[model samples]
Target: MRLVRAGRRAFTGNADVLADDDHRAQVTDYFADLVRPFGAGPVTDLSGQSYGEMAKALVAEVVPAAEPVDLLVLAFSIHDVWPGRATATYLSHVCPGTPMSFAVCDQGSASPFTGLRVIGDYGVRRALLVVVEQGALPYESAAATPLAHRGVAMLYEEGAGTRATEVRQYPDVVPEAVPELARRGVAELSTGHPGARVVLSDSLAAVWPDHPDHTRVPAGQPMTGVWWHLAGASEDAVLVGDYDRDLRYLCFAVVAADQSSVD
Candidate 1:
């Protein structure tokens, strides 16, 4: 299937608070202007509402009204799913009237891509994919990384926009095999678009080395990679997201349009 339109909403974060002057350079290799933060401050509290509520509302707003959605697939990180927030209830609230609805959870950053495959396997012609993540609590000093509330929506249909050629997940990857695995993954996708770029997820960013057309932007959330590809980056690119080193599962999405039409 292909994406028709996409939108992203990031709450309460700015690009001015990098830990060091060299952080940006180390991130993208392009001398990025600013690093976007997803943690505390005025920007994070834009709607003066709860992250989950605002995120669901944003999904309702960003999804194209003109499109006919047959399926609603909601993706969330472990941080978003909590006690009392039943998935079925939220689905009804955010995507009422859809004939079918489902959720992808526990995959961390790989859930969104899994959602895409779900649509394809179910033969749904039109679908809505939503992913949301919230920042770690202010007092949670044990948090691995500063979290931010973020959400993204994408409208997908059978035959329009940028097509996703291949979406595959690998299991039990060894550290010794990452370089070769990454190289082979990129090489396979590059066959069609020789100039395609690489967008590495947060999991693989530190270990993956830079290459021509390589752009590293840590996915604050699972589906954030799709958001970045749709909102920024080259139209033809490869997205690599690894869920866990121990679980060793890696997900890759190769996006490209008709090569003849691509410039």
Candidate 2:
């Protein structure tokens, strides 16, 4: 298993705060503690721009020469709602009139979100997106951008990609809300792959404890999804999301194992 913790910037408990050295240092320290158990070599110090860029850099630097692993733990957060793709975080965007946005990265100026896969062989090979918690209001897409959930609706509406995946959402903010994001993430996981196993996680293991480590925490269930690509789809493993914080701060387990085994 390979664990990687990356952050584009730091909030420093101050939403009004600006991005600067302190924020960078804070991000570094935060990721340092996060990646400690996993290994320093695999951890990347990305404190500016989108995590996708960091992902691009990390894969080129780390994954290429490293050994193969069963799973890759991705812990990334603080990306603008505005859409764009990258190595670390996935991108999606929407315009005001659109029914939904789309997950796009590779086709930055183009139409396809193909650019999302950055890692050489590790691109979409049985990956997982931690479904990290998002702020009440982070940012919005431009009027010129096509907007919606992962921007899938726009493409389907426009007949962009012939293939499409299904996702169902619940109403409640905690269990329902997080699951919505997880479902969307899982849909992204199933793209291009024939069959896949979705891995679940424990909410008790979330990045944040039951109580608030920060001043305010979102009220929701932890969001997580484990995707086994076409290669291991036959295993037919289902993984539930588990974490220390209940839907507050979520991340996938970097090490590969049945995360549901413990409390």
Q: 96-199 in candidate 1: lDDT tens per residue?
A: 34437777887767777788778778877777777766664322234353256677776666764444646766667776666667777767766765665566
Model 2 poorest ten-residue lDDT run: 149-158
Candidate 2: segments with Cα more than 4 A from true spot: 1-50, 57-76, 79-164, 173-198, 204-263
CA lDDT for candidate 2: 0.27
lDDT of all the models against the reference?
0.57, 0.27
- Superposition TM-score, candidate 1 onto the true structure: 0.70
Q: Write the per-residue lDDT of candidate 2 for residues 108-201, one digit (tens) a residue.
A: 1111112112211233322222222222222222212211111001001111332222322222235434544554544554553334344343
RMSD of each candidate?
A: 11.2, 16.8
Task: Please give each candidate's TM-score.
Answer: 0.70, 0.24
Q: Name the best candidate (by TM-score).
A: 1
